[model samples]
Target chain A: MSASHPSDQDRNESLPGEAAARRVVLSVDAMGGDRGPATVVAGISRSARKNPDIDFILHGPKDELDRLIARKRGLAGRVTVRDASDVVTMHDKPSQVVRHGKSTSMWSALDAVRDGEAEVCVSCGNTGALMALSMMRLRKLPGVNRPAIAVLWPSRNPQGFNVMLDVGADIRADEKDLLQYALMGASYARNGMNLARPRIGLLNVGTEEHKGRPELKVAHELISEAAEQANFEYVGFVEGGDIPGDRCDVIVTDGFTGNVALKTGEGTASLIGDLLKEAFKYSPLSRFAAVLALTSLRRLQKRIDPRRVNGGVFLGLNGPVVKSHGSADAMGVSAAVKLAYQLAASGFQEKIAARVASAVSLAQDAAERGTETE
Target chain B: MSASHPSDQDRNESLPGEAAARRVVLSVDAMGGDRGPATVVAGISRSARKNPDIDFILHGPKDELDRLIARKRGLAGRVTVRDASDVVTMHDKPSQVVRHGKSTSMWSALDAVRDGEAEVCVSCGNTGALMALSMMRLRKLPGVNRPAIAVLWPSRNPQGFNVMLDVGADIRADEKDLLQYALMGASYARNGMNLARPRIGLLNVGTEEHKGRPELKVAHELISEAAEQANFEYVGFVEGGDIPGDRCDVIVTDGFTGNVALKTGEGTASLIGDLLKEAFKYSPLSRFAAVLALTSLRRLQKRIDPRRVNGGVFLGLNGPVVKSHGSADAMGVSAAVKLAYQLAASGFQEKIAARVASAVSLAQDAAERGTETE
Candidate 1:
């Protein structure tokens, strides 16, 4: 469980949880995780117990969902079950899902978000399939050429996290698309991290202005010029080493590079965690040391746990949708649900749409000015 | 100091240190390191003490170098200091260095290798400047469109390291360039890690053939087809997480992504190391625990220290060049020298040239076959 302040509980108590009170509704795909519906149900129950002004629309097979929800403790008035027959398997291809996934739980979850029944959708399914379904159901926002998936990265910043975009939405983004990602990512940081003006960085091999590919150079100029309109500060270029440091709040890059960097950072953290555990168990003296250092180690582990930050938000869509990790357990799924609730509560979709629109206009104006000069 | 075996010393002694016996000579840029000539001299002393068949051509001002080497007892006869009045400062731009750096220590070091006086050149200067100077001085090997820089990354392999290419050589690599990176990286792994048939993996966001950019798909096919001729096993596409795993020995990628992944991995490891120290110093009980676990922790630290694996080898060049980290200390510099010595002793330059030449021929053949099929 997360460490909650007393003020959060007091605010939750002040808001009524009844349907008539218009509580925020999150659509949940209650199947397709590695651990199945049981974990999803447990995660929803945990969230429902903590947040009083939230409700869920659970999508899955009626019989299986009924059985799972019956075993949970806090689902009497906070859940609405939606019967769906099909499940999107992890092995299903994205193109295949687009053609034959009409009845799948993942599709139905996104449909709820599209139909205005839920503010956001949360799913732990095949990423490609989920992304395809979300794009099909919600469609891209106007002036957005490419949609991006943004995730929160642990950093040394005072806010403890930074936003990185296009983790896996698409493999490539041109200079214009990168500028759009910066604008959208800055908006996400403003809403997610409560910063009025987020510092944005374009990810490259080196921080020097003269370094990196040609597209990055153009993107740097565009993002720098658009920062005032986008309500963000352009930090020029940043390298991968700065991703975990306190230099920038938003890192923008093509999905290919961003996804690789994200996974590489995760893998490195996991390797070190495993090695540390091995070190603590090396001998009797070390085992004794492990016991003495248990509290501090646990605190450190909790601080950097991947399960605590388990969702990648699909930006540039009609409605916000979060893709939870496929192998996530109850804790991970709960983290995703919490992210969905927060985004829905903050109305992040409208903010992102406005930001993208203004940035697109700026880009078009710059293009027209260039043509006139030529 | 490294844990060395008696056989290593025996093999080194048998090779003989005399010029007639063809001792491996390394050209070292002794001016640009943060610690200046003192650290470079100490590093050469360490290498000279360890490998009897190795000699150095140290490039710097002879007056200051003589004073530094005189304090180090083992470096007297093994090092031959070449006086160069000018030094390449870290702040110098690569373009500026290319235009007006004839008298600099870095240029002299690389010139020695180009003139066949040394087998390899090692420098601890600005990376961009060093890379530019190496490419200019050594020239590209036959059929290499864009030369690559291969680095030794700590991994779970039996050799305890993996070879990753194009770390910061060039930002863009097309399908052909990627294939060349694969070939060059495999050669580096064979000579550097002593793996006869090194497994080569193309770095991408996903491992599936259908995933990533169009160029990656073409590269996947090209590298998979050319594996046999390149004398390495192709592991197809690999994700960022695989960089530290045992799935492959060589990871081929463009300079942009490779550099980002390398720095991200370093940053994550540094963060964990810092957190571990914080945990150990939390309280009195933990302080006692730290004392008890000092030996095991020290072993773990030694196992993952970046200094032990210092130096990024510039592949696809006429002669080998290793770039040590700018902030490296004596131990780190010594590690770079040792790597340069091993690579020079193994005749990696000729081997990489041969590998690139053959791979290019196969690519040309494949192109002709494609034209015929069309």
Candidate 2:
């Protein structure tokens, strides 16, 4: 596989300066986005212009990516194009991809992180396939039964975003899995949003102590007990409404509920946006009002735009991977790249690993104590 | 208990004319709402003004309700004030409410529907307590394992609202329950939205056939098999985004997921509204634009207002019960009363009962056929 991509080695060896080696290298899958590799190159170019201390291990067909990269002056010596024959499509099944996705650009991109060449991998591809390839190449951290995908949600918080997890990693999460999600989500908030001691809220139907499924009750107790050891505040139970409110900085739930809540929020925001447009276009006066209010409306749009928070970081993996939206444009991809760079700079992967490792031991000790008391 | 509330019988017999007996009588609980009986009475008065063929059996303390109803000239001959000594507070546990809530307005409200004195019941109370009391008083229909709470969501459909069920009835729903929810939801759509044959969608994490929990797959097959016999179109799996879209008329899921999605959507919509307001207030130019766009903005607001679609109907019971928002104002209460009247006029209770029975038999037949094949 390495022999097939000779251009990767050549590009790396032909770096312009020794100082360039110190730049944060992000593994990027260029072929899997809906807008194709040109948008991806443009996104990386945007990031290169903003951040002087970053490089990209661009994975795709070498000739096509090289051509795209050559057009961007800012990305000249900042990219190392890797050759891969296949592109994992949006419709590809995760199971099939894991079995036969070796030659795909997504797989090649993950290998750059797996081989210690890049601190992070970012892909605008099928989320399930990206998660699968990431798990296969990077593997789960020790003591992690399930790796979660955490995303940033626009919220009423002063930081302007709330962290929510496992937004479609797997459907089911038991008490232990939820506890792990809380740990990982809190770490993400601390690093991603700069929360000193992020407040953790367990997502449920109601805020009552005795509501929701049996697992949630157990998870509630587990999360509460671990909050002290984990160095985060535990706000017992939170409903879906609290996800966007300032009630808590991190919301933890099973992937099923979290995913549905994420999509429902997105769908509703999109609907409201569409209705707003229709309202402006309803009458001549309103249309003119839209013009006068353009600056304010644009400011509102910039505040809540989903593209501003484009990356969904896969947590509990050996190496961090950011799954950008498949339909992301250049700005969206640049947002993801910026997030990946931040996480890499903050040593988020190592911090969360330490958090989960401590949590596992804490759980084991609590279980042994429960057995002794019984 | 009925003997103690003598005012109920006296007011019932004090009707204006025999023609009033032909009107739709809604059993409305006046005390349990966040706003007192005044808001509830104002709500019924608004409804009475708009709808000539509707009357109410207003349940609460006799003296308080009589004063409130006497003030509303529109509600003079239309309201029958029932005396109930207790009020079910929002903080009351559902189990506690069921055991000791016999004297509450919410309980008395359901009794009017249970005893055939009213066609439907409407209450602005604790949803958990309302559902518990509804089940206790009206009981589940035959072959109905779990009763579901269905609400009207603003959608892209021409009808402007799509039905989503099991919003917070119970945390768990097996395949059979989900199938029954489909049946009940379809019936609600047909009667509530006046759709000839409603399209039903099963809510899941993903739209893929192989995705989601094991029970959802089983529900997918069961719902598919029953669609033709149940007189609805099965759209297979739908994700959360489709809940507000026009992809289907009915979205069915277990109570946990449905409740979370509902709250998440409401929260997101509210957040956007707040952000929009903040945007307009940011600058003097934008404030002027807001004044000019007031009518258009008002139009948009009315179209998506949650108050307009206020009722959450408890289905799969012998009688229908509308659970309005506890914080609903007079206009919100009027919207709920309107929904309750529409449901009663459409013979929605009997229609859903018949639909569920036919689905039970259809499921039985499918099971037998499956056994034969096996």
Candidate 3:
């Protein structure tokens, strides 16, 4: 799809200089979500209304998107549609997509970010495919052996969230890759959480120095040495239970372990939540108690609501990209959009690139120094 | 520690024939816990009162344990003290313990099970030290590469808990090791949950067959082929979210992932619970609502209490040895003791040994068959 439309140029020319200067354009894939294009359009409309400075390059079939966008009063002015005839289904393999997914909306959305037309891209498509496409289009940052997906987990910190990395970018990470994750995650925390220096912890089975695999021990040493250079405090090794605690702001782990921990945490919270509702509805007495406790329960629910933190940012990429949950509704999608907007506005991608470069050099220097000492 | 006490012989001789036949002696390590010998003694007393047929060989300094046991009304009759002066501090490394922990109560406790004086062993010591002692004393069952620590996680299953293996055993598991874990976990489920045939799932980041590391793919094939011979249904691959769901009765994963997920699940639950309490105590209205919801809240609290399920059973060893939390109180210790008693009474150790032996043979057969086909 071409971007040099006469109407688009006219609309941009009509905008006041200050308003146009402040605009942050986000590329959004309107296809591939389980809820379909209508939800995506509505989610974008919700974000556009809330944040006047945000603009969207909506990628999907033009006819359908135009009809959907017309239903929302103020969304038409902020949204620009790019027609992509094909959709990436959840069943499509990442490898297959890379080989032949040119016409898909997911690819087009990522292409917008790659072409510098959008500051960030957001998609509720298949995570594997999205990661694959993003990596192929945006490419990994220099010295980034393995790009990571950093997620915001509900935590006891004053910020109410903690950044966890390598959520599912790749299944394997060597000691050095873990070190990179620590650095990238810390940068994300610093930029996203507005922390001067975030506390980073390496996720292990135990906090003891000698406890866990040999690689973890090596990673511990590497991360410890790199902490000063990376500008984040290393909290040593932390247990999985520390993920949601105030012990660390950035929790780094291999994607395999981090992904499992992430899903396990979500599953557990959901299980307890469902059980609590069941308890409240058990009998007439509990039903009355539930009514009395409704406000407190609502407050608690708002505190732990998964939708409030719905995005998993693809770190170590050339441009910022967010993978919203496949089943995310309008609010969840809006949350992801907001996170993307925040990252794009703050130029987080550039910050992460600089941080990774320095961290890698420091780690190499430390390794060489160790060899010489030995 | 001598087992040939005149009073023990006298008690055995004095018991009625049926009562003596039904008795199951549990070897107890009465040291290394955060609460010390008093809590262990109280825990043993609690278990002894609840089960008339249960007996204990308590290991600790005789002078200290004897006085502690004397204070309990009915404990002296059921508990026989085996003096072990040395204690394995939590700070002690596993390798050091294996080399020089012979004089520790943790070693003596496992030795009791090794000598057939007790059907099972229960200890609230450093997990690494306890596992080391158990492995060194009891030894691994035939054809077992790595021993796994199987834990009971709260689940939505009919049993209210699911068995997850390698919770904090070794941090690594290959395809063969995973197959062994599957068999051992299934056997534990059969005995612990009393299921005729349990559904076993290989834990992964995703349920897709083509996803995850290479070893997991191999494990999926191996476990699938060995399921019928191993007397359990292989439910293919499962994700972290499945740990607390009804999709599987046993979740098998490498210790690194399992331990992290376990701790993360606990941490997330705790974070949410704490937040709920804070929400309830925010104002007078919430405080009044909390009072009204006290019974329901207590029910929920009791439902998820870690103390109720307080044992991590060491599997793939010659006999069952339970590792209770080091910081356990009387209630937690009693819960571990109860699990030990149940497993010992049901001959769980022998059952697991036989199951592992057969499962190992079946796996070997499957591998050979595949080689012949190739």
Candidate 4:
């Protein structure tokens, strides 16, 4: 693999000066996904064709990646293959990965962003391992105690999606960390969803002020106070139903709860979809009905398809990192690549960093006021 | 309303001796729901028509409830309307209800159970207020610390539903409480779902042992230790997806997470259904397809309809209490009534009490062993 390592300098020299200067480079891990490297190469190819200004630094076995990328004309001069001898398995522990995963493709992909060679990193590897490597390489942003992973959920909102944070970064978040999530989530909504002043809601069991855990109550006060300074409207408290509702653009919660909610929502949608298929196949009349309703069914499928929103962005980090679904197909991978490109193009990293910095000071001011009140 | 109170002695005398001896009475609160008392009366009527050995003690403004119950011939000899001067509104706080709600229908309904006049109590009132009144009237079962609310979730299991506890009883639960919930939930599954040996899974962010909050890990060990003695299989930790998956028959968690997961699942299913309707209405062809596929669509709807399983049972209390959906229609309320009748018929209260008692001793033994080990 080391002998087959391709020269990035040669690839850079081959690119036109104007195109190379205008393109935003993305770091992609080609191995460790449930589907293998072919899907990753296909994804970058789709992105390359769709956005001429997007380029990729794909990390994997150099010989394999070079052959895969060579098959796509659009990705010819747009992708740079980096050699990584080892790959992280899905079963690898995060702690073990941090200690012994230097030669893995996931590590190499994050290193591209840490070295300032790419604007963003994307991978469909083990989430725990990837987050571990991302924190080790890219580090956390200033004033961010615990980083969060923000994902887009299909919603009835005008933007067609709501941003939910801490979908499995760390399982626990205190009042201050939740406040930071609110600020960072608002920044994400603004840059990713194009909401000017996103409405932020804290996820809880009920919308009542006096409900939920004690930490959530303190977080409610902190998030409510920071909303005005953070430039996002605070929507008091929202329940789980409000996640896909039009009540708010950003929902903030601890990682454990958010992860469970995300998976539950996905599981339910998947179950309904499966039942729908079984319904359509129940009888010959229904099978004929299915043919007539093919377009409508496909339309519904596309509207709620998990593949359409394939990336969970790792937030509050030095550089942006998007984790694609582990079993993502070519199209799902493409969606993740497209999200990464958009985030990179919007310069979301700098904006989120600034928002988090101001939020830290706002938290300090609130603490001082609490002391005075006591 | 006081003048219109129906005489229970007259109704009881009208029934045949054999029928009265076998009838299991359910107390129903006919106020505080979003739709009001007409739906509640209609629900009990639906249940009464289905089960020959069921009777009801309907609590509400006697004038209104009597008028509603008289229209259903099935409920003519089975219902004894109790006079309740006031109704518990949705806006009433639990604290206020506990202190000043003696005259409310919700309070009167629970009193029937506490007084041993009814086998189970069913309410469609404000959940917080209902839980508070139930606690005040019926008290906790022996060896139970925190009472939990358990609900059935539509799942891929052979039983078609999984029991999840602490959906909204209280926000916090410790290791002992979770262990008790596991025991109580297992008993509910045995009697309610007819599972001889139910498999219980502790809900967590990940199935891995080292994930989630500190309390979950401790609960995991305690529940595992108590499973064999309690006659249920402990399947370790399960994620939110498994709530609707076939991996386990019971999901145990704190009230906060379970409530959120339940609501999130419902919300996601609802959003998809709405999107599906919009898909079928996209064009004239899709409209024609909708007409042709009505039967298939209805079958699918019946399978995933939340109304089909519309009750949340409050566990760990001296008497079983079923909380119908606040916005439930007549059909939804009827499903809840049916569940309450079945639970009463199975003597779920006594079984759960025995399980909780044994679990208490099991927990104490584990604690003593831990002290010795330390």
Best candidate (score: DockQ)? 2
**1 versus 4: better TM-score goes to:** 1
The Cα local distance difference test for each model comes to 0.84, 0.87, 0.86, 0.85
Per-residue alpha-carbon lDDT of candidate 3 for residues A1-374, written as tens digits (9 for 90 to 100): 00011122223332311224446789999999999999999898888777776788999999999999999989967788999999999999999999999999999999998888888999999999999999999999998888999999989888889989899899999888888888888888877777889999999988878777767878888888888878899999999998999999899999999999999998999889988998888888988989999999999988888888888999888987899999999998998888887776667887888888777778887656544543
Best by TM-score: 1
Model 1, which residues run further than 4 Å from truth? Answer: A1-22, A367-374, B1-22, B367-374
lDDT of 4 by residue, A114-140 (tens): 988888899999999999989999999
How many Å off is the CA of B143 in candidate 2? 1.3
Mind giving the per-residue lDDT tens digits that candidate 3 earns over B186-266?
A: 888877767889999999988888789988887888889989987899999999999989999999999989999899999
Q: Higher-DockQ candidate among 2 and 4? A: 2
The collision pairs in model 2 are: none
lDDT, candidate 2, A63-103, per-residue tens: 99888888889888778889998999988899999999999
Point out the higher-scoring one by TM-score: 1 or 3.
1
lDDT per residue for candidate 4 within B15-81, as digits (tens), equals 4223243457888999888999998888888877766677788899999888988888878878889
Q: Model 1, A55-164: lDDT tens per residue?
A: 88999999999988988888976788899999999999999999999999999999988988888899999998999888899999999888999998878787777889
Query: What residue runs in model 3 are displaced by over 4 Å at the alpha carbon?
Result: A1-21, A369-374, B1-21, B368-374
- Looking at model 1, the pairs that clash are none
